[model samples]
Target: MPGIPVTAPDAGKSALRRRLLAARAALTGDEVAAAGEALATRATALPDLAGARTVAAYVSIGREPSTRTLLERLRATGTRVLLPVLRPDNDLDWAAYEGPDALVRAGRGLLEPSGPRLGRAAVTGADAVLLPGLAVDRRGLRLGRGGGSYDRVLARLEAAEARPALVVLLYDDEVVDEVPAEPHDRPVRAAVTPSGVRRFGGVEEVEG
Candidate 1:
C-alpha cells in the first residue's frame, strides 16, 4: 500500500469509505445473510438483470452486502456470470463463475473464480455489470474502496464504448443523498437495494 500518493481531495472519499465500512461490519451474520436474500430478489427483479446474457459480478467479502445469493440465482438461470480476479497491477482480469466450489481464495480477502482467465476486455461483452461499493447516492455515484480497481474497470468500459447496464448492489441505507464525487466519476445506471430498486439516467424507461 506504500508508494501510492494520496491527494488532499481524496480525504473526503477516504473518510466516507471508512465510516461506511465500519457500519457494514457492525451487521451480524444473520443480518448479512438476510440482506443477501433480499438483495437477490430485488436485484433479479430488475429487467436489466433478468435479461442479461452475461453479467460481470464479484464475490462478497467481509461485511459488504452479500452478492452470493444473487450470483447463484443468476447462474441457475444459465446466465454466464463473470467474477473479477485481482491482478498484481490492481487492474482486473475476469473469469466465469461456475459455483461456490469453483472459487479460490486470492490474497487480500478476495474469492476469485478458478476458471480460465477471459482477459480484461471480456467485460465489454457483458449486458450488465454488478459492481461492489460502500455506497451509491441518488445521483448514482458509487463510493468504492480506495483500491482504484473498479475505477480502472469503468475506464476500460468507457474506452471500449461499451454501454453495459451499470448497476450497484448495496444495503438500503447505503443509497444516500450524496457522496464525494469527481469529474471523471460516471453515474451508474441503477442501484439495487434490499428494499427496492432505484433507477437513474432514465434507465427505468429502457427496462420498461
Candidate 2:
C-alpha cells in the first residue's frame, strides 16, 4: 500500500506549476513565435502605453520567449524603460535602460541593465509596470518564481499612493480563474496573455 497520503492544497498547486512550466517550455518554435507576435500586437494597443512617460519591464530569460520586439517598439514611442536589478537584500534595484545593449547577464542567469542604478523613487514615477509571472488569474493574482522580489517592490509602490498600472505577461493558458495568492503577494492590475490583455479586478468588460 502507498504511504499515508499528503494532501495540502499549496503543495498540490506547487506541483502543478512545476508541471506547467515544463510543458510551456516544450512549446514548438512556431507556437512561441505566434505567442510572441500576439503579445506584441496587443501590447501596442494597450491604453496604458499611449501616454506613459515612464515604464518598467523585465528582461526575459531562459526558455522565456524574448520581448525584444516589444521593447524596441515601446522605445520608439519615447516611453522610458527601466529594468530591475536583483539586490543582495532580496529587493529590486531599478536602472534606466536605453536599449538591449544596456543589459548584462545577472542574477539567476538573467540579463539586466547596466545603467544608472535608480531607487524605488524612480519606480513610483512610472506610469506603468510590466511584471513577470509563471501564471495569473483574472483577480490580478500572480504566481511568480517564489523570489518575493517583485512583491517587495510592489509593496513600496502601494505605500506611496502612486499606483502605476501593473501588467503581468503570460501564455494564454496560464491565465486562469484563480491562483494561490499568499498574504505578501502583490496583486497586479491586469494580465497580458498571448491573445490579449485582461483587466483584472476591473469593472470594465474585457473584449477578446
Which residue pairs of candidate 1 clash?
Answer: none
Residue 137 displacement (Å), model 1: 1.4
Best by lDDT: 1
Q: Which candidate is the best by TM-score?
A: 1
- TM-score, prediction 1: 0.91
Instruction: Give the root-mean-square deviation of each candidate in angstroms.
Output: 6.0, 5.4
What's model 2's lDDT at 99?
Answer: 89
**Candidate 2 Cα errors over 4 Å, as ranges:** 1-13, 202-204
What are the Cα lDDT values of the candidates? 0.86, 0.76
How close is every model to the real structure, measured as TM-score?
0.91, 0.88
> What is the TM-score (0 to 1) of candidate 2?
0.88
- Summarize candidate 2's per-residue lDDT along 1-208 as a digit string, tens digits: 0111223553455765785589688988777777777787787688887679888888776556456667888899888888888888888889988888878988679788898899866788899998888777656778787777887778888889888988887787776656766777777887777666778665734647
Residue 204, model 2, lDDT = 30
